[model samples]
Target chain A: MVEVATILLMGVFAALAIHSNVLRLAIIYLAVFSLLAAFLYLLYAAPELAIAEAVIGSGLVTLLYLAALKRNRVYTIGVVNEQQRDHLSDSYISHVERSKALREIRQFFLLREFEVQIVFVSSALDEALNDPAYDLIVAEDGEGFAAFTDDESYAMLELEMMVQMHGSGSAIRFVRHSEEGVV
Target chain B: MSDTNVGSESTILRLIVGLLYPFMLLFGFYVILNGHYTPGGGFQGGSVLASLFVARYVVYPVEDTDTEVLHAIQRVFLSLILIAPTVLLFTGLVARFPHYRGLYLTTMDVLIGVQVGFGLGVAVLRFAFFQGVGKTWRL
Candidate 1:
């Protein structure tokens, strides 16, 4: 019974690992598969190999995969210009500055080999800020601009540096939202 | 997989991780030190020890773990793992005293454990650093 159960679990986890589209979930499934393989090894009385399998195969490999996945992920930034209306004729100077800022931001991320996706949102700035779908949000605030990001965003430091260096005289402020409070 | 996904912020998770960390470390060391009579050995224990760092990374992804120190430790232990056996062989200790085999095995196991632990820790730290988890993302 135990042998049959271990084999079943091994097969299930192996299938899950192969079929899962999410890399994290696939790595987790692979961990489960390794754990089941360890159990199978233990059943065969190869306790030494079983322990090795349990530790290296399940633990170390899973972490390695997660790290690789994180490094290769695409970064998405949402740009919500509250001043942008369909019929409004924007001033040339401000428009040029805005475009320059956007280009600088894109170039900064591109240099780091990250795929930068600038998503233009027509919704309200507050709505965009609260939306969990976006990793970052750059919105107009009065005469200046505010970049809103959560504490978890990895590229925040680089983004901040880029904005400070090439924001083109715009009063750009970084607003970070933590899990507990806004900072 | 998303970069914006922060570490677990729940009090329950924090409490559980805090409670379990010490035990994990203890068991990992146990596996390393008692490998002769036990099922686990250096590699297993090393991986277990590395898992402790991985768990800490999961709980507090922003914590700064010194990868340079870990790398140095791994290199030192790896050298010891290589040098110790060669010294033992050249000194005719193993040949003269077969009774010291168990001691030699245990010493090697401990050295391997430390080496593997720090090696894997360095890997994890490099991953965290490159992924821009903490302030080490300068590049």
Candidate 2:
């Protein structure tokens, strides 16, 4: 009965791994599948194979898949404004959609062969900055605009230069989000 | 999905991995040493050892600069593994010291374990460094 349940769970995870749309979710499902496989190996009394599968399949393979997925084509940017603090206003959305700086930034990334996805995040700027999904975060405030990006980002210099050269009159400060204390 | 905090976010995870690190190393060596009497041998033990590197990488996403040294060490171990058996068997050393057969097997297991461990660790380190953290996407 235990073996049957393990097999069924393995099958489910395998199917889920294949069917999942998100790469990370698929990798996680695959890891879980491998873990089940390791359990099956243990049930079959193949401790060596179980150990190998548990370590390599679930651990090393998952890390490798995640590493490969890191080079994804999509470059996500979260756009936030003070108005989004309470709710996502339709006017704010339209305004962000029609922003020239956003268009320029999109075009910049598009020229570099990246699939630019501008997400109008309703979260606070600080919250959006904390989320690592956004490669870049553009926050609008009373002053002007603040773009937050990873300090270790290779494109930081280029991005800064581009922003400075092409930005309209308002004060746009590019903030490097250091990963020192966050870890 | 966000790649930054895959394994780094949870304090429990960090603490658990920290606690498991030494035990994992000890277990890998134990498996290798006891391969003659146990189910697990060099490859399994080596993989277990390699997972230590993976765990460290997951928690602290940093590019390992010591992979070249690991590569060199792996090559040396590989050569030793390939040469040791031939030298031992053809030179009639194994036949002469038949009582040392257990010692020989354990030594081979240790050599193979180290080789496999270094090889897989280097592979993981290279992958983790080269393709890590969306660093490849240099816009």
Candidate 3:
């Protein structure tokens, strides 16, 4: 009965690992799968193999996957409100939170296999714009969105096209920020 | 990226890992030493020791800069592991001192355990360092 349950759980986690959309969650699922495999090894009276699996399979391998994911660079997008003095107001924060353009931008980056990190900046637009840490700076412009990005970045070209295809037509205007001002 | 330190910020996690660290080392050593009669042998114990390094990295995600030193130690122990068995068998030492066979097994197990531990530890540390620099690290 114990072996049957372990086997079933192992299959479940394996399926979860494959089906998980987020890479980090997939890694965790894989680790849990290995943990179940180790338990099954122990039930089969293979203590030696069980110990090895628990350590290398679950522990070391999970860490290796995490390290690899960490090496994969994240696409950081900073959202700054235009004409904001002092801290970001609650209204602007909620508006950006509910913005459809922001969601589309996140989806665009996610489809390209880049981890999307949205940073909310309370500082002035010009101050946040100079920070080279941000891959793209998104600011609300009337009814549309203004996206400031490095002119050399090819990903921005693809994103611009994606926006157009979605018929978000001119809703997201790409502004090529000069490299000279960044450093 | 805002938080520069990749090490865990949770105080409870740090404290728990800190408490468990020494016992883990002790257990690894115990397994390696008693491997001749126990279910765990060199490989298992060695990986346990390697996990200690992994746990340390988890609690404090600092780049272990001594990967070269670990590599050196692993190579030296590996050479010793290879040499010890050859020396025992070819020299007819094992044949002469049949009673010392247990001693020979323990010695080999310890040697193998040290080699495997250092090797795997270096692999994990190098992976972590690669993650930090986000560049190809030579050596």
Candidate 4:
């Protein structure tokens, strides 16, 4: 009975929140929904996913959304296409906005067996985390994302991964962008 | 095209980047071809190719050549290159099945090639324009 009520309640809020432009309302809905998912994960004994979703989905992603809202006025979101497994083209996001959702792509990439190499050339920090193989990277930035960052640029992803292996607060060795080959 | 620091590159390193560039591009395509089985894919190879083009213009200036039409073509093709992959990816979602994902990725590789080629080609021309002075700067 409680499960049915949750399904109905969530389904209604989700459907109604589909096209609303109110930022507060959208954020609230996402928060509540993510919490609900955490509850389900706990019920199913999948604590890791529950925690990840709560921290990442409910916490970090929301922070990013807030940041984006601060940057831009409008927020546009797309729905998830459940059946999209083997399409040639990529752009089928629906559940959330693009960049925000893209931020979570690292999580999905982590769950997969294939390695991911993302290059972000901006003033911001490198955000790739949770993946396995990260190779031949170039970043002149400091520690901000991936929970850890190397101080230099142009090093194998292998080195960074090995360094980030200790914990979230670990720091990879720095390799200056202007400097010559391996030290 | 805007002023860049490409002028300072050592001729030898430039020579190596130039000599190895075409084969590197071809290798990108090779990665795309075997992407499903291998580690590389369309977007990776595409990005590498884009860098190659950027390097080419940094090495060679094409401002003296007719590049406006070529630049326009590059912009259109780059947008298209990004678009087509998305279409195919979504189509797979809608159909609830995997069709020709490999072929789709391959085609995406081709589009990226066109984009990287023309984008760098046009960028070189534009950057070269910055060097124009006196009579060369005539509108």
Best candidate according to DockQ:
2
Q: List, residue by residue over B9-65, the lDDT tens digit for candidate 4.
A: 678868887798888678657655665675555444544455554555446633445
Residues B87-112 of candidate 3: C-alpha lDDT, one tens digit per residue: 89788999999999999989988998
**Candidate 1 Cα misplacement greater than 4 A, ranges:** A74-183, B1-8, B131-139
lDDT of each: 0.77, 0.82, 0.82, 0.49
Docking class of 4: incorrect
TM-score, every prediction: 0.61, 0.63, 0.66, 0.31
True contacts kept of each: 0.60, 0.86, 0.74, 0.00
DockQ of each: 0.28, 0.35, 0.28, 0.01
The alpha-carbon deviation from the true structure for residue A30 of candidate 3, after best TM-score superposition, in angstroms, is 1.0
Candidate 3: docking tier: acceptable
- Cα lDDT for residue B44, model 3? 92
Candidate 4 predicts chain B with a TM-score of: 0.53
Please write out the lDDT profile of model 2 over residues A88-174, one tens digit for every residue: 778878787777667767767865657787888877767777787887888887766677766677676777777778756524577
Model 2: per-residue Cα lDDT at residue B121: 95
lDDT of 3 by residue, A1-183 (tens): 999999999999999999875779999999999999999999999988998999999999999999778766577788876666456678977777677788888777655556787888777677888877777889876656788767577788778877888884445777776745532
Cα lDDT of model 4 by residue, A1-183, tens digit = 666666677676676557555766787677677777766776667654654455445644454455344323421111222234234133432322234323443333333322343433222222222122333232222332122223442223443454456455443343433233332
Steric clash count of candidate 4: 21
Sort the candidates on TM-score, descending order: 3, 2, 1, 4
Better of 1 and 2 by TM-score: 2
**iRMSD of prediction 3:** 7.0
